[model samples]
Target: MIIITAILQMLRNGFVLSKTVIFIWGLVLSHALVSNGVVDVFADFLGDEKYNLWKAIMVKSFLEGLSAVLKVAVIHVSEAYIGRFKAIIFCTGSFTMGLVLLWIRASHLDIVTLIFAIVLIALGTAGKEPTLRDFFDYQLREKVKKNCTEKNEGEDKEPSQEKERSGKNDSAATNLWWSTASIIGSVIASFFLSSDHWGENFEISSIVMGATCLLFIIGIFCYYPEEKPSESPLTIPYRVFKAAIKNRRLSYPSSKQDYNNEDSDDASSEDFFYRTENGEVHLLPRHPSFSLFLDRAAMMNNSDDEEKVRKEEVCTVVQVRDVKNFCLIIPLVVTLFSYNLVSTSGNTYFVLQASTLSSYNIGAFDVSIMALFAIKSLITFVVRTIQSRYKVVRPLWSIAVGMFFSVLCCIAAWQVERRRLYLKKPDDDIPMSIMILTPQYFLLGLMEGFAEGGLKNFLSDRLYSESMKNFVEPYIEMLLGIGKFSSILFALVFYKWIKDEINHSRLDNYFLVLASLSFVYLGIYIFYAKFKFQRRRVAVPAETIQETIERMDELLQVEVDINQ
Candidate 1:
């Protein structure tokens, strides 16, 4: 449906560069090839009869979690030091290098290649991913903004309908390409991993990655619009923390001089608001308690040192407010763990369960158990089309829908595992068909389609400003890592349930406990969503009062559209 929309929109509104679709295809391919490909890769270790099976699976989770941790550091360097474009170049280069190493690992099958390849692939893609997603929207927005400005300056005073149309088309086109890649990649990987030709799959993956990277780089110069990176939002917190430490002994200043100008932040507003990367001026919800302490970090000091006076000008006011909001947003970001946990299980335990099931051959091709993840992706192919038509009205609601799907997946898995165990004879192989796991995989695909995107929207779309989100974006990505790592801990705590053979382990019990935990997590999420974040009108920054007023209506409309 989304693909159809893109074609029709292109036909009606004319067209864009063919390379635009190609560029989007390359980006989506980079994302898709590894979206959950590692599960199969780890399953290969078990199939090869190499290391201990369960440990190999845990290693995969650990490496993924570690890569997620590295994502934060890499993004920090990208956003804070090198420009995002350059960071992507460096990261993509790393990712490509990882792919080459992964190909070598596939060919040789050794510990050295194995460890280095997975880490670099995981690390490089982790850095590229969140930035790539953000950059995609960022460049499109800048292009549309420039077009509108140019058109408005002319006599007609109309917006650039072409650029606006292009934005809509690009959004649809990207979704279409991403779904196409997921389906093709999943099917191809599943087919290849089932046989001795799995190494060829890696070889093919590496080659495609190289070409895509080249196209992505070329498109940047010739096709995509150029926009300079904003000053990193992260600098604010660094300065605030540094100042807080220096002024540690100082009491929370209560004087009027300590506060920012009322006009800068609309101090009279009942509550505070934040926004996306290119968002309106925002004020964070203030806490009378710790906020006063953060205030000292920005407030004028008693000492009239020349350096202090100069630094205070840049660091006070907006910086502290953003930092306070950062503090407030942390808990919400942490609340995202349940979805991450469910997602990790999709890649880890689901693959394990599928590996243990009986395989049915289709004509000449033997579709392996690992292809179950592909089934999940195939479901995603359908879900993305449906999702485009009816977006969730609120960020919280999107999250709720996603989490609900995840909980259902857990329940379904619990039932399936119990059934598989029940029918198994004491001394014979389990006779369950791979098709038996289809429902749970479908549930997982639904969870993947909605939950992750919903979580991202809450942060990068509505809850953060351009400067503010840079601080939290990587951490939010960390939820993926945290979930994977926690799986290791969960395995340790419930060691009896994770073993070389699913039939031996109490996996049904494990899934049931997981379902119960998910229910609790969902309850917690609902509790926080009810009281934690609220929308209210906010004031512009001290520096942009006039420009902000001109943009306020547009900003409000953006917020309204996001909610409904």
Candidate 2:
């Protein structure tokens, strides 16, 4: 719900959705219909009949965490090889297969089948995330380009036509319609599969998953094909790493004259570093910080043959700088894992805590835990809207504020748990109203609004190379997966001491521990943001490059005509 809500808000703020994004969201909505309601029920079933509560919790966490890891691995390996549309198709197909297996397991009450299905579902769901994000980003860039072109052309147009033709409002509305469809699908599924209708839940969920697969197939042609690099995308990074190591001991030029000396007189004046025998530029100017040794890959030796140098050194300075760019952002990315660790607790332990409280009645219907997620989503949307309107654009500052709220969320949970423990008797319902948990949920939503948006903006703006931009989504997803996996491990270790039984559990202590970690992480992030990180220079516009090429082509054609 948080993720869906965030994407919708982003769309409203002019973010675009491609067919890949729509297909991925469809699969997600299908999975949510099953997982959100069924997983808890499945866990309860196991706890009540087959296993202990701790074991059930471990089983659920392990499947989810392992799935996340596998998802990252698959995306990292396959994203370069496959187109985004094909990847979506493959992932959605996997999801459909997993749903089939899940249906079988549910019907037969077979634990082994259930376990296998869980693994398959994890794999399918994991791969879709980064791919969908990349597609959305691409579409967003296209939208920005269109808007820029329109603004440039608006000067010559009549005011009425210009107003009528503005793409911004139309684009936003289109994105909103897609987001609304996604939300509506999830809500419909949730209504059919919620606790009140547990008996037919798996059957309904399987049908939804099948329908989602068909929907994805229908939209396969809707997205524009992502541009494929002429050379293998991985080649540059691999060559950079290899060259950095191979040239580690080489001495760099000591003077400006040495740096400027070239083996060939015909080298292009635009070349920042050495030029190849074939007239290709080899490098750009080196970055000033971290991984400075990579610059040695571009250093020219006085005795070296130009052809031999070209053959031996395949990396460009731009590629080396790209690697360095990732190095600079490592600290910030690592800090996010800490925030993710705290966030994981919300989905697992916080839900458990909420389940124990007296249910809130909305007239005839008692509000389920899933409904609380809607409340959080609503709050996040409101917060994001306000931020967008004010143009409060400091991402790092927003992330810092989010971290602070995360700490407060933990503190709130700890206090509530402490109170519940003090007030409740054995076998008695929790004396506190479920609404007491509302503040934590609201704070979490606010934290997500600030932190996630800030991180996305910061990384996208700071990355230098076009190729490197593709990596931002996978890298963030990897961190999130690791955070969830690590949190589960942390919980397991603490479980020996804290136990899983609600009556005897010291879960408040766990929340306190996370609160402390969040506080420490916030301090470290602040220090890194202030003193250590340096933003890369903005990349040249692709449109400008394309125009220059077109102009050169026109001049060449004119020269040919004159010669004829």
Candidate 3:
């Protein structure tokens, strides 16, 4: 309800509200549907076999990479569209294809069927999605601009003297109305999608979704004006509308009643900073937002000059030469130890150990331990909620805590492995009790909740610069994809090295590797603290070339201060 109200106010302020809402809705739905679909498909392919951790990880990574490729391809193709509605349709169709692939996998469909489906989906996505949307937006923007100018001219209003146009007008109340309707439609669609019954009703849900999509797209095309003024673009008004809707300029008391509800407060804030650009120095307000105005192409033109500075900095690499040299040695040891611990960790052996204890029949998704893993994910979700609600745990601190928990989880798994080893005294006898391994899997989920979650937040916060914050989510996801790729490569190498060894029950050896890696990482972190890391690097103005050179030289000469 609050989101709905806030969205309404945003639209009233004249912003392009539908696209943003759609993007968010699309991201959530796409992720959920794709995640479930892929998991279902992969479980079918793998069956209930007790493969090594490496093989499981490999299949997961490969599927993830394939998903990434599909996503990227869809995005590129969608960009060519002039009509946004056309693009949306294109994207929806493309992503649906990916979803279908998973469905086929889950159904244990033939390889030929899967191949044929993929080829068709790929072709549809690559050929159609991009161009339609690009064409739509281009035409829509051009028309809207012309209409706005004509409307102003009829009223004999003076043209805006502002040099820039920001896309805020698209967020105005009317625009919000469109978006609100879209959100409603999306929410409705989510309900049907979420339901378990698919007997004949599945087609109905698909029809509803298709109809809603068409309605929204057609509404945009028919409602928006056909021509725009060449003299006055829609940019400035859009910019103004954006600022007003975002509530970028105001501060309110934390008490709920301090302002007349969130919407009123937002409206008040919008009034304060509408159409304003540039921030005053040394005036940091409680809530602040900045817009990126500079063009990236302009920045790229200066990259040649940027490389020279990097080269000179490399020369000064010798200043801390002794320190970095010493630091480099630790990661190798840490890498080995961390790998060792993880190998024997509960997650690594959970599957093999769990199957023998009882007849844990596979779920509809074909997963052997659905109920257990789902509960773990739920616990992690609760932990995440608690962490978010209470600001007690800082991002980096959460990361540190997660790492601690991960180590503990690994150690606990080591204990289980040892117990299992002891119980199987010489005559191939395995422990039938699964309860022993339960805590290890539980801890793995907890560790994931803390460490991986924290790492994700930290990386996103640190690497997403002001200009590229919008792209940060995708970029980080791409990095995650890269990490998975690396993990796959690492597993392949490990398999090659150990495949020849006899009885190779090197499980203990693997556990040791991870534990040692963690310690090694800790040491390297200390070294980073002692030498390489810097807390606050305030840029000193260097107006002249000589001054700039000296400044660079000074930075090179000084050892990096770890503590800010």
lDDT of each: 0.63, 0.63, 0.40
Candidate 2 clashes between residue pairs 3 or more apart in a chain or in different chains: none
Local accuracy of candidate 1 as per-residue lDDT tens digits, 1-564: 665764465345333234455674575565566554543455544445445646666777777787788887776776667766677777777777876776666646677777777777776677555676666645544554555566566566445565565566555544444456667666656655443455655666667677777887777764454455545656667887778777767654444455344325455342223222233222344532355466556555565744675655425555666677556545755776666667777666776666666787788776565566677776665554445455534556667777788889999999998888888888737788878878888898887667655555555553324567544557666756776777767777788777666667888888898888888888888787775554322333545555666688889999999999
* Stretches > 4 Å off in candidate 2: 1-53, 74-78, 107-114, 133-178, 195-199, 219-236, 254-290, 297-313, 378-393, 534-564
TM-score of 2: 0.73
Query: Considering summed lDDT, which 10 consecutive residues are worst modelled in model 2?
Result: 255-264
Highest TM-score scorer: 1
As for lDDT, the candidate ahead, 1 or 3, is: 1
Spell out the clash pairs found in candidate 1: 275-464, 277-466, 393-563
Q: What's model 2's overall lDDT?
A: 0.63
> What's the TM-score of every candidate structure?
0.75, 0.73, 0.46
lDDT of 3 by residue, 1-564 (tens): 543454455545544434534433333333233222223223223323334445555554554444445544444433222333444566556545544453535335454554454443433333221233333344435444665665566575545621112234432433333334434433333333322222222234333334444554555534443332221112222333343344333442222222212113244232221122243111111111222211111111123524633432111111112122222223322322342234223322454445434332234332233334444555565455455435346655564565566666666755766666566645455644655665766776676666545544543443212222222333333344444455555545556433321123544444445555665665554454334222311122225446757888878667455333
Give the Cα RMSD of candidate 1: 7.8
